[model samples]
Target: MGIEQKAGNMGVVTLKLEEVINWSRTNAMWPMLFGLACCAIEMMSAQASNFDMSRFGMELMRPSPRQSDLMIVAGRVSRKMGPVLRWLYDQMPEPKWVIAMGDCASCGGVFNNYAIVQGVDEVVPVDVYVAGCPPRPEALIHGIVTLYEKVKEEKMKDWA
Candidate 1:
């Protein structure tokens, strides 16, 4: 017999399972432990209490890019460090997301010197840009949520 005939309702069961899997995947965003400047401090603060980034399931900050799914560029990108950043970004696994977590990472901030890369977008494709000299914890949280929304909106076939 067909699935519809064998079961009173197979659709609900399939949907429930898919919902569970997607919920688990979206909630767990393991960010790589990389901080280049002052904004790094803000990133850490977001993970700490008060702001409590753990509430959104991003508390586990992985030290290795191989294990991380999210890369939070939390500072200025100097010419000397640009190559290193690119190398690290390339190391991250598939389905990865990049969060430019400050004006420095997003647009070079006040450091207009020739040594700066102007913006990290020049090195990597950013998924979200969190603006601020040093973006507040709330802003970082919002960026993560936005990334989650994007992940949800993406078509499954696109990943294939």
Candidate 2:
């Protein structure tokens, strides 16, 4: 429900679990570190002092998939790595989100042969697609902010 005015100074408001969960999720997103190629550098820069991803509540990039809820696929995925990607995604807990963090991760980018998987979505679902050969650190922040907006609107019925 939208914000409402309290009848008195007692201070009480009504909201659903999904809305509360979404609020917590957006503010405390922990992205799994799963970079695969050149775009990985840009992804790393996002965590550095200059960009400071901690401001967005993501200071520590989790190396283990089980401990994180957000996944930033930061490069071109290869056909050989498809199963690994899927396995990691499977390992993450429910209500997780995925960000395809570059043209390479979103699509095949420059590589268009049998080696490249064409897109990370081909292996696992993508929630936000950050567009660029290797999108700048600022762009990554934008993507995170965009995901936060999306999370803020989610409902319990929307999940499986």
lDDT string, candidate 2, 63-89, tens digits: 999999999999988888889999999
* Model 2 spans with C-alpha error above 4 angstroms: 1-14
> Compared with the true structure, what per-residue lDDT tens digits does model 1 show for residues 1-160?
6878876666654455445655777799899999989999999999888899988888899999999999999999999999999999999998789999999889888999999989899999999999998999999999999988877776655666
TM-score winner among the candidates?
Answer: 2
Model 2 C-alpha RMSD to native: 4.9
Which RMSD values do the candidates have, in order?
A: 5.8, 4.9
TM-score per candidate, in order? 0.87, 0.89
**What's the residue-level lDDT of 139 in candidate 1?**
94
Q: Could you tell me how far off, in angstroms, the CA of residue 20 lies in candidate 2 after the best superposition?
A: 1.5
